[model samples]
Target: MLKHGLDPADRRRPDRLSDRELADRHQAMQGFLTVAGPQLDQLYNLVGLSGCNVLLTDAHGIVLDQRVSDGDAQQFRDWGLWQGADWSEAAQGTNGIGTCLAEGRALTIHRDEHFHTRNTAMSCMDAPIWGPDGRLLAALDVSSARADQTERYNRLISAQVASTARAIEAVFFRSSFPGARIVVASDDPSEQAMLLAVDRDDLAIGATRAARRALGLEREGAIRPRPAADLLGRQDDLHGFDRGERAAVIRALARAEGNVSQAARALGIGRATLYRRMARLGIGDEPARLSHD
Candidate 1:
């Protein structure tokens, strides 16, 4: 709070961006808003009955979209939780949306945890959303002013906020890599979403933040394409001539539909040589299904 130059006693309401300025900001984040809109609505439907409001903010902490019940809308607006509001830590002090963006993690700031005394009446749960390019994209937040909202309840809501943030990131990633195959980098459910986008040729063209970090990739910026099999530690054709030959044989066999003679012909090799290669490659003999043609 001291570094942010915020006074705990400061009770002035946070200022909102001018309508025109807010419109420009929205225009900048139009693509992200489109991808995140449905997720925000779902989050609201999940928690709205409990007097909570869902908010999606750009990286700078400007609320670009929100879902609030009509009955609670007025109160949220008065508290500066509406769209166009600036909740960056610099502007609003230590709060859920701002602090989450500041720390790049999920957190809950219950009553009295707020840097400003005026904000203590509200409880906030927030998570940072990472872009497909592995950069901070936005923040997902749920806030409630219900007197009965407890710390335990806030924890549950924060879990949902984090999950929704990851969902938005995944959707944004898929949208960014249209026509590419998405592969999960790890089977561990505990880690952040680790995903890779592979082109039709089996080269990985993109990766999520967790995937990039786990793979020692450049955190942000253009990702150099790499063989998906190589990255996944699989038997890659790029590894050696034997693997390349194996891949060629497998592809030819698939195309020939178990016809060994046809597969050998396609590989420009005799059936005997094809059998020898297959034996060395550990491929199962399918002679029973092999057609002379």
Candidate 2:
């Protein structure tokens, strides 16, 4: 703000959402609210006692939900921390919701760390809420009013808020695909905890954000349909089945109704190559036909 020739000393708050804007944001966040509802309520209760506020914001930083204690709502509102507030770092300038989105990690922004001097007395801790597909769905935050805020108290609240964020992520992935097997791949407890979703055959179909981070995947959708063993760090677990190259070919062949050419197209392999892999996998005599019918 200082560089823009605007004075942080002016301490201007962002605009509140109009009725239509609030409705649109709520409509867009319906799915996120479904998974995050329980956690949101729990966090609200937890922070209410501290005279703080809890907020849930969409990935774009739109305020989807904002809650304060029984008597504190109006006070927080006067400060511009309302249900329709746009708290993205761009809008609020280095506060919890916006900074969390920019960093993609959980942490606290205390007092003077805020971009505007107006926010200098407030402190906030925020954590990212993610979807089953590893996309950021929303952020959960607890903000302290300057009057009663303390550096030590802020640190404790930050950890507690992050725990709730993890729970929200778990709910998202579990609800997204209940039939899929969920597993923890890391032996180390300190590594970020995550769940890998596998098909009935134990092939990986998807993963939570922590699992992707553990595997050093920098992008979403990095986990493809492959043997879960690749991430389990255990090769022995893969030996029990005729999987992958063979199973993909078999499933393709079955889907093609025994037409080798059609199966080749489906599997993205040449007819001869498919035949060769099938033979190498010791299924050369396998009958190719429709079991589905």
Candidate 3:
């Protein structure tokens, strides 16, 4: 704050967004709220059973939504965990929401880890929520009053919050492309894995940040990242569709039961386009056989 001309000693006086600013933030995050609201409510109910309150904040760290067990609601509010409060690192110093936004990942800020002295009475765990296009939309946090049990609870809640964040990403991805094929690329069906949206042109249209990282989809530009592909050998198409496109085609076909029309529809491409891509990629007469081979 020294650089910003604000005093760190003035931490007691909280800052908040104005009505116009709040409204703009709300409008900016409307779509994310629509998908996250109901699911977060369910999560709050479950997590609240453990005496923790749940909060959702925008990318800017303004608490957009909060849910707490009635008995603990006042306690949480007293700690400044209510909606519309600006908890960005600039405003509140180090905190779960603020720190997570700064770090861009899952985190748990225990007592004394908080920069402001007043907020040291609580422990917080948070994870970033990403949008369909792989941008950060918000963060989900769980906070509990600090006590002897804090260390144990922080570890448990951190993992749960991170899992919930991934579920939120799944919702955003599926809602963004209702017609595209949703493929779980990981071999383990029960584990949280990379979910890919295969587009009509036999290419990947969307992938969660986790999937992108797992597949090594390096950032090509700010607006969009590149596709993930298994490294192919000599059979790989050079001038036409590459390994990435081939993998997407195989996965889509496998899920669609080898029906060219169904696979084409799932990829959001026409039957002719699917055939053309397959032909150009040097796929032989038995394209369905390619998936098994």
- Total clashes in model 1, counting residue pairs 3 or more apart in sequence or in different chains: 0
Error of 2 at 178 (Å): 3.2
| Candidate 1 structure quality by residue, lDDT tens digits, 1-293 | 88878888987778899999999998988988998899988999899988898999999999989999999999998899999988999998889999999999999999899989999999999999999889999999999999999888888898899899999998888888989999989878655478999986678999999899999988998799997888887753335677667777888988999898899998999999998988888788766755656
Q: For candidate 2, lDDT tens digit of each residue in 185-239?
A: 6776543338788886768887888888777654585566777876787653225
Per-prediction TM-score: 0.85, 0.75, 0.74
Residue lDDT tens for model 3, 1-293: 45445444554545667888877888887877888888788778777877788999998899988888889988787777888888888888888999899899899999878877878778899999877666777899998884764587678878888888888878877888788777776777654536777665535667777666766654321224233233111244453447667767777887877777888888999888988988877666575353321
Global local distance difference test of model 3:
0.76
Q: Model 1, residue 5: displacement in angstroms?
A: 3.0
RMSD of 3: 6.1
Task: Rate residue 273 of model 2 by lDDT.
Answer: 81
Candidate 2 clash pair list: 89-98
Q: Which ten contiguous residues of candidate 1 have the minimum total lDDT?
A: 235-244
Worst 10 residues of 2 by lDDT: 284-293
What is each predicted model's overall lDDT from 0 to 1? 0.89, 0.77, 0.76
TM-score of 3: 0.74
Ranking by lDDT: 1, 2, 3
Report RMSD for candidate 2.
8.1
Instruction: Compute the lDDT of residue 63 as modeled in candidate 3.
Output: 90
Clashing residue pairs, backbone N/CA/C < 3 A, model 1: none
Q: Superposing all C-alpha atoms, what RMSD in Å does each candidate have to the true structure?
A: 3.4, 8.1, 6.1
